[model samples]
Target: MPSTLEQLTSNRVKLTVEIPFDELKPSLDKAYKDIAAQVNVPGFRKGKVPAPVIDQRFGRGAVLQEAINDALPSAYSSAVNANEIVPLGQPEIEVTKLEDNHKDVLVEFTAEVDVRPDFELPDLAAIEAEVPVIGVPDEDVDERIETLRQRFATNTEVDRPAQDGDVVVIDLEGSRDGEPLEDATAQAITYKLGSGGMLKGLDEAVTGLSAGDSKTFSSELLGGAHAGETADIKVTVTKVSEQELPEVDDEFAQLVSEFDTVDEMRADIRKALESMARLDQAADARDKVLEAVIGKIDIELPQALVDSELEARRNQVSSQLAQAGLTVEQYLKESEEEAEDEDAFWTEIEKRSLDALKAQVVLDKMADEEKIGVEQSDLSELIVRKAQQDGTTPEQEAQHMMEHNHLAEWMEEIRRGKALAQMVAKATVKDAAGEVLQLDRIQPDGSITDAPAADEQAEAVEADASTDDVVEAPETVEAPAAVEEEAPAEESAEKKPAARKPAAKKAATKKPAAKKATTKKPAAKKPVADK
Candidate 1:
């Protein structure tokens, strides 16, 4: 075998490979056997037909084509290794020469493909980024305490008209143009007034409604049969209940938490919030430092690779918007995004995609240079984190990884993440106050220790892929307050409604269906062999 590489561009290359008859003999023999089993001759049994007879029956070209196809994958892989090229995508292969006379046999082919461009890494120690000072506000701690109070709050039937924060059980009927919409009707549905997760105008319409009171209001259906259509909505309030929160005293503290006094509980809450603030600052530092490093180096990216990434991101965003029944304009408005228009949103997306790709390339190069490797513990930790994020068991996530052949992909993510940590660890990170930040000494509980926490490795694995928040497209949009779902009759009135998070929280939620462990078919290795 003989091969030669030609650099077509900074990020593209062409490889020409020649295979002698002896090198292809194994593939040729297998091809003949396969053809012999598939064809029959007049005097010979099935699979007993000789290669000569099969060649005479089907022409030598057919055998050669099959053998060449069988051999192309190994030949291409070997040529790539021999030339040490990191091809980005599938190659456009052409069989430029083939000779099959009695005395000599040979096959020659060329593959043109995009590849990683060579680039130099800057000094990590010179990189600098400043993150906000970590300060937990009193209001944030109070909010967390209030959340805990709400969890223990008791609901009681109220006699007067319903008010904000009151839970109401009502029968709802929606009709579009005077025609009843089955999907928009439900009975004994429980909703919190002013929660703003149901249909538009629902809060105002039910604000002064007493038990057995009926009110009709016109609003657009958020989901189901009349999604995005305006309908006349009639609500009959069956019950209204007001929540009675217990006083925040020592007894209350003892009941709701491990602390025996309100002061102790408040102290604990403040401590937890401070810890969270520190973690937030650390994450911000990681991203900012990585961004600063990227800004220092210039790398030529292949247009084809950029285009593919952009298309994937576009499709993902489009799918999310479609599922939420929103156009780009509506999503940006409801989400309060800074993008002024759809064009701006997509442009931002393109920029983010390119940045993520560049980050991936840089991290990969650094990993190779530093000889970063994934350990079994790293993989185990990754699986646990993935399981927690996906709301599945570790066993299930492990099965999914194995089923989808994601070990290599995830290992790369881990490797790149470690490389990123190494770079950030060496960089000079500072708070807005100009105090140098020591990331390695930070603990998961937000405490500073003499040594790095045991979980630091796990955190490092996540650092490289944090860009997924920017690059990985949305699976679904945060369901806007403008949307609502029809509840089934079998659902209890006290049951939480099946819908997106309230307008107050815009975090994306995963779909309810458990992820199926789907095994992907391996990609076809046979390249197009034309003679």
Candidate 2:
């Protein structure tokens, strides 16, 4: 085989491959077998149509086209392998030569496809990630302990108007222009003020209204069939009450925790908070290192990649929001885009997707260079962790996930996680004191450590992708709230549609499904092959 390469803009390449007629014989034979199996010609059995007779009836051009169609994928993959090409999506193939009558001649074709542009990896040692050495603030310790105290607190009825933090009993009715809405009314509903967990304008409606006082206000329904619909709401305050929190003492500490002393509980809270802070710090360090490494390298991304990524993300986000009981339209409106248009949302998705792609590509290259690999234990640990979170055993969860066609996705995610773990370990991480911090490696000692406790909040992308708060990692390992966790599921979540700590988080890259032509006698059609 002989081939020539042409560089096309947009990170695409054109490969013109030439093959001697003898080399095309295999595909020719296979195409004949396939056609014979499909079409019936007169007195012959289903698969007994001789090549010569078939050529005479269907024309050699048809046979040539069929053969080319059958040959394209293997040929392209081989050529790509031989040339060390890294394709991003798929390829578009065009057959330029048939040589139907001249069996001794050559067959030639050209494939124009998007490929990953090659870029050099920066030294991992040179990358620096600064993590603040966060200590448990004393006030936070008190706050955590106070939460426990509140749990054991008793509620007492009050005769005064409601205030923030006060629990109120109320009767609520909602109607749109005087038509009562079903499922939009509650009786004796106990709501805590300042929680903002109810409809818009709810806290204001009953705040100063004492028992038996009724007020009507216009507010938008938060959920149910009438969500996003404005409804006139009427409320009657039945009771106002406050939580009589247990006194912070030794007895209260014994009731809430294993420790018997309040002082001990406070100390325990500090340790727990400190551990959480370190995990948060770890997550931050991973993001910083990935970003720093990406910033050091410049990669020319394919437009096809961005388009595919964007389309996938659009679908993924839609899928996720639907699961959480929200519609795309409703989400977009609530997002309040700066441009006040859908374009702004999509533009931000594109940018984040591209950045994630670049980061993962760089990390993958480094993984290969450093010979970092994922181990079975590493995979098992991750599976077990995910299983525990989902309330199932690891084996059962892994088996179910595999049965549902997620094994490959799971494996790829594990590999990328290990790769990222390697990068984090090798990365130069420093604390607020400028002291170096070494994060546990991904199975460096054959025991995988716990990943950072990811924040479970789902950021409304259409509303918040452009916000400075949408961090770098994904939500879960895979979810629409982040990037498409497949398609290289750019760890660019949050790309995390993972935890957005490492767009590498959502590393379950999906291969876009290729389109298959449905020509009955494809041999007679044009020899062009597509992805």
Candidate 3:
């Protein structure tokens, strides 16, 4: 096998490869056997048809095409590896030459594809980023405490009209054009007057309505058969009640937490908020440092890759908005984004998508340069973090990871994260007060501490092993099958990029052979399982 690379562009390349007759013999043999099994012959048994006989039935050209298609992926992958190319998208493969004559049998092809361009990393030690000092406001603490108080609050029936903060039990009858809508009717529904998540104008309609008092209002149906249509809603109040929160004292502290005093609880809350602020600051610092690094590098991006990423992001956003039952206009109105119109919103999305791609490329290059490797411990930590984020058990998260064949994807993510952490550690970070920030000591649990010794780390993992079920993942996880870089000439020109193709695992990781977990999935909860 011989391959030659040509620099088509700074971010694109052309690879011309040649496969000898001997290298293609295996594919040719398999193609003949496959075709013979699919076709019936007059005398020869199925799968035993001679090569010349099959050629008489199906042209030698067809056999060669099948053989070439079968052999393309391995050959192209070999060429890519030989040239040390990091492909960014699917290659445009073309069979430039195919000689099947008895005298000279050879196959030659060319692949043109977008690739990652080489760029120098900035001097990370010289880069500096500043974040605001961690300060938990008194109001924030009070608000957190108020939430706990509300959780323990009790309700008592009141002989009075419904008002804000009052929980009212009511019966609803919805009608459109004087016809009753069965789908829109409910009885003995308890609603908080000022909650604001229910029907529009419901709080005003229920307010001042005493028990047994009835009022009618018009609101759009949100779901069911008549979704988006306005209907007349008749509300008959059956009961009104008000919440009585527990006093903010030692007794309340004892009831809500293990703490014995309100002061101790408040102090804990303050500490928790401070820890949360530190985490937020760390995240902000990471972003700022990454942005600074990106700003320092000058790299050309492939337009097609950018377009593909933007399209994917748009589809994802559309899906999320649809799930939330929100249109773009409604979402923008409710969101804190500065984009005021659809055009501006999509423009922002494109910019963010491009930035994300650049960041990916940067981190990938850094990982290569630094030789960052994903260890079993790294994967275990990732699974544990995922479980915490998804509110599921670590075993469940690991099962999901294996079931979905995300081992390689997660490993890459861990490598990139490690690379970023190294860069952030090398960079100078400071707080608003001009005090230097030491983020390298920040632990995965969000606490700032010294790195634990190897034995201590092992012991910690052992302690959590019962709950985490730390998988013994291989150092290298194979990626999902990619699109064949070699294709039939006709099909090669229009093949969708590998990123856009429907994924089918050629060698998916096997699910654990242990008993399946019997814990039922929580309602309205799902793991963020996609890579």
**RMSD for each of the candidates:** 5.6, 9.6, 15.1
Clashes (N, CA, C under 3 Å) per candidate? 0, 35, 0
**Predicted candidate 1 versus true structure: per-residue lDDT over 395-508, tens digit per residue:** 999999999977877776677778777877889999999999878776655666776666674353254244353223233456453335433212322211111112342223
What's the CA error at residue 166 for candidate 1, in Å?
3.1
**Which regions of candidate 2 deviate over 4 angstroms?**
19-23, 38-64, 101-106, 155-171, 180-189, 193-214, 218-231, 236-243, 310-350, 371-410, 441-525, 528-531
Q: After superposing candidate 3, which stretches have Cα over 4 Å from the reference?
A: 36-46, 171-189, 193-204, 217-234, 319-325, 391-407, 451-531
lDDT-better candidate, 2 vs 3: 3
Ranked candidates, highest lDDT first: 1, 3, 2
Question: What are the per-residue Cα lDDT tens digits for candidate 3 across 269-367?
Answer: 777777666766777777788889999999887878777666666776666556545566655544455678888876766666566678778877887
Indicate whether candidate 1 or candidate 3 has the larger lDDT: 1
TM-score pick, better of 2 and 3: 3
After superposing candidate 1 on the true structure, give the runs of residues whose Cα lies further than 4 Å from its correct spot.
41-49, 102-104, 180-187, 194-201, 218-231, 443-448, 453-467, 470-476, 481-531
- TM-score of each predicted structure versus truth: 0.84, 0.70, 0.76
Best by TM-score: 1
Summing lDDT over every window of 10 consecutive residues in candidate 3, give the lowest-scoring window: 480-489
lDDT of 2 by residue, 124-182 (tens): 87788898887766877776665565556677788888888777778888788678876
Candidate 1: pairs in clash: none
